[model samples]
Target: MIEQFLTSYFVKNGEHLEVPPKYISDTIKQYTVAKQTARTYRNVSFLKVGQLTKTKPSQELINYKFTKNAKRKLTEDFSTIQSWIKEGWIIEEIVFAQDGRTAKAIHYRIGPSLKYYFDAQNEQQTQRLENYVLQLQKSADIQPIKELLQAVQQLNEFVAMPIEKLAHTTKLTPHWSIEKRLRFLHFSIGFFQLANEGVLFDFKEIGATLFDKIGGSKAFDRDQKEFIEELERVFSVQTIDCGLISLGKITPVFFTGELMGHLAIIDKVLFMH
Candidate 1:
């Protein structure tokens, strides 16, 4: 699915069979795609046969192995994976030998980098989503999230607390605490936003600890990584760069009366359910 999307992205924008590298960034964001991890693909190829057009590359056969239950979903958003970019693997420049005898033109676009959380959607549709979020805030099924906030209020070691300690202290198994699978997708929006603001220093870590992917999800699901990607695409969410701030003085969040009240609204309405 992801490979197909990547292929179509260029084709849709191309006036001819081949697309220039200039369109990659905008095309990726338009589709809400994150990272393109699929290895082999016909980055740019000419079609020999087509149902509609024989000359257009739109009908080209993509050289991809479609497998069952592949992790094809666009998971990550605009990534700060500087390493991939530095190594030039994110967008590899490959040269295909012409007729397997001489060098031909090179293809420089094959992968993606960023996709927005909610991009180019109609206002009414987005409003409906916002209303759904409001509904979730008041939902009764959010006991676990509410309970986690209460636990954090009492525990000074909330962010840095060990998962085992949290489970023991809360009288719940780590397994029980995990929001089942894709729930992490819709669920962590506020948390990611807060994390982006550097308010939830341990938000990502605590999230990972809670949902460690035990025995795979019962249904098709996405993990914290996917959730983070989706959230970051919409909002500028990222971890605290330790170099920017002093880590030695990193103390726990003091949960006092006013603080608890503030956290209650944030944790309950923003993060829960």
Candidate 2:
């Protein structure tokens, strides 16, 4: 009964409800059991709000009545409410009443995971949620990510080959600058990662940029074809339609720890040159 009332309240308001015990006591006094229970508990477990409808609460009257036992049941459910607080579903705090500091109310402020309570609602509520998420994303720290990438690049397990060694091994042209070699290696790693993830490739755009100094579309097609052929020969990658098709041979190995370590090495080799 409490859950139904709260759901309705949150959906209608899309804001925190100052629900006192008396409010619950009064609300549940309106309806009978079996029928209301059958209507409200439609296979949804209590507080599993995600499975429920993504609609705002209606102004329609709720018609459930609470018996004496039902009232007792509500009181005994404080432990469940406390558990919600621990799980961060609800934020609880005390605030002084307008009249005096002695008179306090336990304010159930909505937490960051407030989306779970209500679904698709008014533009105002949706905008509020979007703004909140944007603020959080804007405040997010990226230094740790850079540090982790740097660490991956430094680790020997992920360092397949140093730039000089790689150039020598591949027999890259003598005229190729270290910067150009690095760029080529990075592109190879990116191509492999994309293919392994079964992503589609846009050969025209990619080839135009990478092979721009060499020639036009035809040269790009030739170079990318060679690149794809080498990948198929070495990594056993499967592709069709001149490498534009999704490749899948590496997908299964992509998540394995050893393969991931090698991928990190590829990332290192990509940048080191």
Give TM-scores for every candidate, taking all chains together and pairing residue i with residue i: 0.18, 0.23
Give all candidates' CA lDDT scores: 0.32, 0.36
Tens-digit per-residue lDDT, 1-273, candidate 2: 334544453323322333232222321111111111332421111121112222332221011121111211122256655543444334343433432233244434332233333323335554754454343233222232332333223222212454446446444445655444443443444443333334466545343433446453333343565555554453344545224553222233233343222223564343212
Backbone clash total for model 1 is: 3
> Best candidate per TM-score, number?
2
Question: Which stretches of model 2 miss by more than 4 angstroms?
Answer: 1-160, 170-183, 205-222, 241-243, 246-273
Superposed by TM-score, candidate 2 places the C-alpha of residue 229 at a distance from the truth, in angstroms, of 2.0
Instruction: For candidate 1, give the lDDT.
Output: 0.32
Q: lDDT tens string, model 1, 1-273? A: 334534554343422233222323422212221222255223333211101111211111122211221222222333422223232223323223423324344223323321111122234555654554444343312223332443223222322334334334432223533233124333443343233343334433433433457532222233445544543443333334311132123355444453222323564344212
